[model samples]
Target: MRPRLPSSPPAAGVTRRGLLIGGGAGVGLILAWALWPRHYLPNLTADTGETIFGAWIKIGDDGHVTVAVPQAEHGQGVYTALPQIVADELGADWRTIAVEPAPLNPLYANALGADELFETARDTVAGRWRDAHAVRIGMMVTAGSSSVRTFEDDLRQAGAAARVLLCKVAAARWQVDWQACDTRGGFVFHGKDRLRFADLAAEAVRGSLPDALPMRVNEDDTRLSGQSLPRLDAPAKVDGSANFAGDVRLPDMVFASIRQAPGGSSRLVRVDRAAADRIPGVLQVVTNDRWVAAIGNHWWAANRALDALAPRFETQGAIVTSATIRAALQGALDTPGRRLAAVGDVDATFKDARLITAEYQVGLAAHAAVETMTATARFADGRLELWLPTLAPAMARDAAAAAAGIATDRVVVHPMLVGGAFGANLDHRCAEQAAILAVTLKRPVQLTWSRVEDLLHDRFRPPAMARMAARLGPNGQILGWRARIAAPATGQEVAARLFAQDAGFRTALALTPSGDPYAIAGAVPPYRMPAYAVDHHPADIGVPTGHWRSGAHSYTAFFTECFLDELAHLAGTEPLSYRIGMLGGDARLARCLSTAASLGGWEGGIAGSGQGIACHSFRGSHIAVLVEAHVGEGQAVSVDRIVAAVDCGRQINPDLVRQQIEGGLLFGMAAATGGSTGFTRGLPDARGFGDLGLPRLADTPDITVELISSEADPGGVSELAVPPVAPAIANALQAATGYRLRCLPLVPGTK
Candidate 1:
């Protein structure tokens, strides 16, 4: 449960805090705007001060402790992780700790948000607090695997400073130096004089606060790394006490279900609202720009109403049919686009050595989050209250405020527990829908998307087609390579630029690959091949392609690693040795490859199973993965084992690292062998679970091992493990059989 802030101001601090007196007019404006809403500009700020949950964390006289967390609790385990960070820092009594979510604070923002807001429209921040003291970015949303990374430093520093302050208070009372007082488990001790945290709370607050403090985050100060600490959310999840957004309930809240246009965009010609009105408990039928929603007393009633309310839409015929899109994407591989990268001269190299060209294709995929799209909104008493769990809150706030015709301040967005958000919740559609309906009805409305709708209306992972051509030197070295890809323009252009600045790669040429792991490898690889050129051309398409875990790196890794295996085979050298020779002295890559190979029993192992390796560096972190698979006579491929090694620099939480690896492996397996968002007649054909074959528990590999380097900084572990899995599996298959499969989800006969 979230903690409640005082709606009314406290008598003492009301004047100083700008509470009741100056706030009422603001509140009135907020209310009036909610009634006749307009787009609400959020008051965003970024706080660089020492943040303690003090206003959030209270020490009762009886020694009970409560810490208020500003972030939402979804499956990411913020509830547990946040409290753990606080408790460890404060040396608080863990048994007596109470955790609660804090309402929006305008003092927290992500690195991505910080970079973006500052990168463009510098004037937008005019007159706003930009300094560390007053610039606190809030509305507390978590994404980009940033919760731990962003808050860890500040919280630790605050805790350490607080402890030092409490000891000073005890020392002052004891007439001793601050160093003489020892602190342990929320208590300060001076010789035999013992003072509980609660007893010194008032004095500690009055004492001088430390403005500068360094966190002793070494291994000696923490037992956090390389340990499988139990997940903080497990108990609540097991007890059914966790409150996902779908579990929200409010007074007089009507239910709503919307049927989106079959085609992406179309004109609504007619809607048969009468049939829906006949449903028991049905309230009203509301039509919006792209969706027709049924409002009813209950969810079932709303769904039934939606079922009966038949609407006709004029199609644009612009929807990309799955088969047509796949074919088109493949054809686009030949079409030229903006040059993203280039290295050496691939055209000249192609004419010099034995060449092998292979094209691989992947299909659209959906973000099958456990909790479907849902939000609750209430527009009453000239105010709007919204309960939603969204990845992108700024846009959500604006959309909801605009829909309700209220000023932003009049609308309050309370992000709730998210069941499972795999990037799809970033869209503001649901929030907009709820606000529009609730405002029209002048009542509270709850909207939940059906499974079919969730899948059909999903912004899919864009289908990708890559044309890779490589030249092998006589000694088996890759002399030249060229890769051209066609897919939706994800933010890869930006990432590629960043990668180039850091890696010295040519960003202007489209075919140049980033961080060519095998480029400078020993003996030139494949016995020895020298001088290579590489580049990439990402074609633009209409499909809605965004970040799907590892982004562009996913396909790039596959093309590079699998193509390496093909070259090794052509040169008649063992794939493992060939890779090792190509990736010399890169200790991180070597560790990962060797660990995966050793674990998979690759050296002189059985011929039925083959092992393949791949490695790449992303966002300063490098990882390598190896896969082992068994191929039977009937064309059935069983993934038997996987081994991965990662050098993330330093480990924050080893358990989380392992979890990320497991997630990446699982998701990659699904994408590699089978899962796809199918389409028919320019519309999504795969509507629900049955149509999309996901990786079931039974399909999981029997053996999986994750090896971490002893010394390294903790890089991002969330999405890095995915890119190598597909190529590893594909390469293994190539070694197992006499086929070089270039497409994803290998069909029985294609290889």
Candidate 2:
């Protein structure tokens, strides 16, 4: 449970940290803003006999250790993985460790996530003291697969500091120096003398920390981090006792069902209040400039009332159809684009050699999480409390505060276990709507979007058209390559909405003077290319675009790997060999390709062989995928087997790594074969999950995953396997049918 923390800022400290006694107004204000000293006290509630140690840990008299986790649990094993890190470092028994969702505090702010959101733009008014400023503003986001990579050091430091303090107290009692003490199995030891951590906790809080924290080195699998520990959250999930946002309940609560404007530059035209009033249980109707809602005691009544009311909306700005979306991308592709990345003079190399060009298309893809948009909110006594499923608790709190016209300090957000996030939890529109409804009704309110509403309002992965151009050397080697992608500046768009003062404004083109590198993330090849260029052509498709699971890497990998397969075929080179030859100094990716080929029984992707190969690098990790697949009757894709080899630096939990890879493979296949929709009159063409051909249990294939063991810093694994699945499938189809399919969803629609 996330308990309420201190809301006010700390008092002034004037030693060398700030000027408090006397100074000019200008100097004092600058010092106060930039150098003022502040301390954040731990607010994680402790039991009667428990004691708080720093901000991240608490210890009970029974030796139970509770650790605070800032990241949300969204199917990934963050709750287990992070605690494993702490347990390993603290030398504590794993059985004694428990997890809690961290409360809002600067000590728990996710700096890595903040950097990811503001990739290339910090030229804002909040640039000064951005770290402190962002934390106070509720920027504690949990996206970007950065939970371990960014927060590991801080978590380890917290554990180590506590361990040292405990040891210091124990050493004092034993008449020994603290530096000669060690911790293991929840005890502090020195020369055959030992003290349990629980016995030292009462006095350890007064001990000072050393200048440098001592870190634990993993020497064997016996260490908790290297082993595959049972998931801490699995028991609750299996017992059906896990609490999500929908499970939140409060006294005197009402349910709401809403319908918002469907298209661009429009608002709610009218609603039949009399018709809604006629519904059996609907108590009231609420209308705003952008949406209308029906409130009732039961959710069904509220939902039924909306159907009877039949609200109408008028849209302008050229009806956004599939044809219009494609045209916008094509127009942008035809125009000159800004260069986001360049290694050498691509134009000069292309001028001397004949250019081989291919353009690939991908339509709009939805997140399709099992749990739709849901939030529970209560507003009373000038304070609002929200139970929300969100990656950014701070952003949701701020947005809800704005929607309710209250101060941010007056709002508290309880981040709940997500049913499925995959980047969908980053948007907080539902939280804002719930806040508005709670304020309007003067009672606790729970708002849920119907499945259709979730699909129709999904900020889709942008529809993009990528033009890939390459010049081959005389000896079957790539001399120069260029990938010009036309898609919305989605990264900037998200950052704009996330960091904007209003929090309602959702455009970033003006804020990002430098072209968005995030739009073309993973566009640069990991191969040894002497010269290549990647450009971004920002297309205004009049449809809101947000991050998908793998972000731009999913589509960009498809474009690069599939086009490289085409080039290999044209040059009479084997697909796997052609890729392995361009490894440069990236021996890790080379080994992944070689291992996958050997294990998957690759047959060179020859005609009628039904074998394919694709590899990619993302988030400091390398992956290679080999699949046995072909087109069946009626052009349906059938994959018989898949083999993946990955080198993700280190595995905090090997089981979780394999789980992510397997889940990502199926997710990417769905995106490639069935996870897309077109727009007609500004509404999504597909309405529900049944329309999207998601994989079922019976459709499973033979799968093998090989995790290379390395002692390097951990890289991201959650989104690693998603990028190459589509390209490998497309490459397999090319080998079997001798026809290159360009667009996504390999069936039905091709742009």
Top candidate when judged by lDDT against the true structure: 2
lDDT of 1: 0.62
Best candidate, TM-score-wise? 2
Candidate 1's residue-wise lDDT over 234-260, tens digit each?
777899997776777988878999888
The local distance difference test score of model 2 is 0.83
TM-scores for all candidates: the values are 0.81, 0.92
Please give the TM-score that candidate 1 achieves against the real structure. 0.81
Residue 680 in model 1: shift from native, Å? Answer: 0.8
Q: Per-residue lDDT tens digits of candidate 2, residues 57-95?
A: 888899988888988899988998898888887888888
- Stretches of candidate 2 off by over 4 Å are 1-43, 117-138, 190-194, 218-222, 502-512, 748-751
**What range of 10 consecutive residues in model 1 has the weakest lDDT sum?**
517-526
lDDT values of the candidates?
A: 0.62, 0.83
- Could you tell me how far off, in angstroms, the CA of residue 219 lies in candidate 1 after the best superposition? 4.9
